[model samples]
Target: MRKEFDLQLDSFMLHCDAKHLSKKTLKSYDQTLRLFAKYLDVELGITDASKVKSSHIRLYIRYLRARGKYTVASSDKGLKVNYPDRREDYKKDISDTTIANYTRNIKVFFNFLKGEREIKENPMDTIEKIKPKRRQKQLLTPDELKLLFHSFDLTKFHEYRTWLQCRLILDSGIRAGECCGLKPEDIDFRSKSILVRDTKNGKERYVFFGHKMSTDLRRWLQYKDRFSDSPYIFPTVRGTQLEVNNFKLSVRNAGKSVGLEVFPHLLRNNFAKYYLIEGNGDFVTLSRLLGHSSVEVTQKAYLDFTDKEIGKKYQRHSPLNNLNI
Candidate 1:
């Protein structure tokens, strides 16, 4: 339960719930709003929403930066649970992408209050996020891929099942949620295609794989047939939809055995990078396959090509490289 000191928070949360936002979005907005309340308690000494000001809201943002809340972790997923950061360590920092989200939500909250005549001015109206620097995409190399695949035992049931899971992600580039949500009905054997329904951004699309993925999926399901039955193409040990955390644990174990990286994010990144380079880096098809809403989003996420490979491209991206990136 949230603390009851702030009326603005109570009203804001009520409005958000009335709007019926998704759970993921609800959690995010709730966290940002809680931070705002904490900021109010620290700086403004105002508990009531009616007393909030443009100045207080602006100061809240400044407070976040001052506390290193806006700093991206030195590495993603840096710290573990049950550990406290030293005074110098501070809050485990969020990424620029994350900071942008918080800023956007805060703006919306203040705007809503303004619309309701609860505030004289919207302090978040003019605040902007620090644009994140373009970071290089991390993808597995050919040898690394070999290491990942060949490291596992094909004869073992659990090992084979995990292999199929990794293969599907690398080949399809489907979101992690889509992977868990997939059902047997989603695939058509004759068509040799899979239809992912209502994926990220609520777009449905069909993706087909060549012999490698199709054959692996079929073979693995055959092995799994003796153990249990479930509608899900990939089911948990108890025959229900597999949870995301379980999948991650299996992938990490497989990677340790293979002496290669095999996490979901890396596999997904490799999928995009390979498809782009193999298809002459066409963003439109790549975007669709990856379930990205726009070509720009795809471009911004994947940048794993070697300098020599990038230089060979006909289109120059920068003066230094004689091409555009």
Candidate 2:
């Protein structure tokens, strides 16, 4: 029989399942732990978690860093078979963000082990969480956004829905997933607020739209009802809920037609920035509007303002400029 420490990972997975974690998150945790187990076996020849030490974990981190991209076949099932065949051509280096996520999953697994008293000492005690650099996302100018809106061929059903969805995202900074998952009934026409049932954090929130977006959405709904009996506000030709990737591709292609490279998230970023700068730097309200856990997270992700933008904001808020002193 496998020892308690040896089967600790299985126990942890069961714990995750009981907590009702998303399938995607559970898969990531399983895959990361499998790779760590493989590292322990091949390098340190340790089969028991109790025998694993902080030093061994450090060695594995270095091993991950030294390994080239694609070289580390996902020790996870199904992907494991192609590892030996594709190892030679694995030249892309693992990104720091990906490495950080892997480290996080490892930490979570070991933390579970400690909590269950499966191990006397925690191997992750000395391991510090890696903070990856935040990449700045591009935002579209007002003119660019206007041009993108016009680029859509409104006559086509898909294009019309895509155009309306883009406007909705810009008006309310709900995530792409949340937008695509919306049903016709989710929108409270009288309140002009959408009830977001599906979100990344698994918590429901409300996202509000402006007058212009409300008008467009109402018109789209009327038009959409004539063609499809789908429950979703935006549906495929077959009247099924629109796939997120298909929605993104539709938006991306429209941007290309207008000589711009826009994506759904960019519109979200644009919304946040516009809300902050034009709406008098209301970070608290913006945080709630974007459905972030906290204002700090919202700041950390979106506080990267250019000097020109800052100057523009300053001109509006300058007491002397407003007072004409």
Candidate 3:
């Protein structure tokens, strides 16, 4: 947001505001464009937005490729950050996933500039998106889910927090950040649900919990006297709401206790897959529950996961037809 940049990202912000775009979307745009500006300043010596061109964007991509991930970014204007000394040599160049995300953001900005006549055209139009390689979705087995659940006890204080944390993540199928962002009042116990605000698409949705979780939650609420001053359901000993980094450690530690390696998203995927299977592969219901904008997004992750292979076996084992044999 500083003045030293060439591209006035302000143009993109105004266009987005006029269109009534959500705050999260606008923030993402602001993030990518600002980082683009920083990259330009550090690598290309460009300061003016009007002179921005396709090649500069291309050069930026190259820099990202050469620098790669694990490469510690130098502090802007000589500030220092303590990043661990770990880096991987990216000899193969930029990853498709990285390029795809960058391309998507810059395309948004360039297209906005074109629409406003601030630029002649969207420079990224001719450039093809880097196709990401196919990745298999990993679903935790049912035993894994059981192991995860049985890992913690609600009787002890530390175990109770872990129990509450995993229970919310699994039952609600919410992102780890959303779960930690939760406050006690956000839960509608009478309705057996919790509000997940600004989920993936900046959409607020209610996720219902199971009977067991609702009960465990009540017992945990008894201990709510501890975090009364803070708004988050889970807070630190010091009484502040939890942050992402702290949540990562807490979630990881909870995972360690269960003898099951779990990440927050894996629990979410378990929620989706189980529901879809139980619903007999119902896409519409699953999509709404997970707060995905489209069923296709839900399908993309769970379709393969729930496809039934036993239909042929049922037909092969039909007893009525066997009587004729």
Best by TM-score: 2
Output the number of the lDDT-best candidate: 2
What CA RMSD would you report for each candidate? 6.4, 4.0, 4.5
Among residues 3 or more apart in sequence or in different chains, the pairs in candidate 2 whose N, CA or C atoms overlap within 3 Å are 69-92
Candidates 1 and 2 compared by TM-score, better number? 2
lDDT of 1 by residue, 1-325 (tens): 4444456666877888887664556767777776666667656776666566666766765666666643322223443531336333457565677667777887788788888888777777556555877657765777888788887787876567667777888887876767777887888877778899846555688876777887877876776666779777778767887877668777887898866556876787777877776556578888888877788887777754778557655353446566454
| Backbone clash count for every predicted candidate, in the order shown | 5, 1, 3
* Sort by TM-score, top down from the best: 2, 3, 1
Question: What TM-score should be assigned to candidate 1?
Answer: 0.74
For 228-279, candidate 2 gives per-residue lDDT tens digits of 9999998898899888878988898899998998889999998998887887
True-vs-predicted CA distance for residue 220, candidate 2, Å: 2.3
Query: Model 3 segments beyond 4 Å from truth?
Result: 1-7, 11-27, 70-95, 149-159, 253-261, 279-281, 306-325
lDDT of each structure?
A: 0.71, 0.83, 0.69
Segments of candidate 2 deviating more than 4 angstroms:
1-7, 22-24, 27-31, 34-52, 63-91, 256-259
| TM-scores for every candidate against the unseen true structure | 0.74, 0.81, 0.79
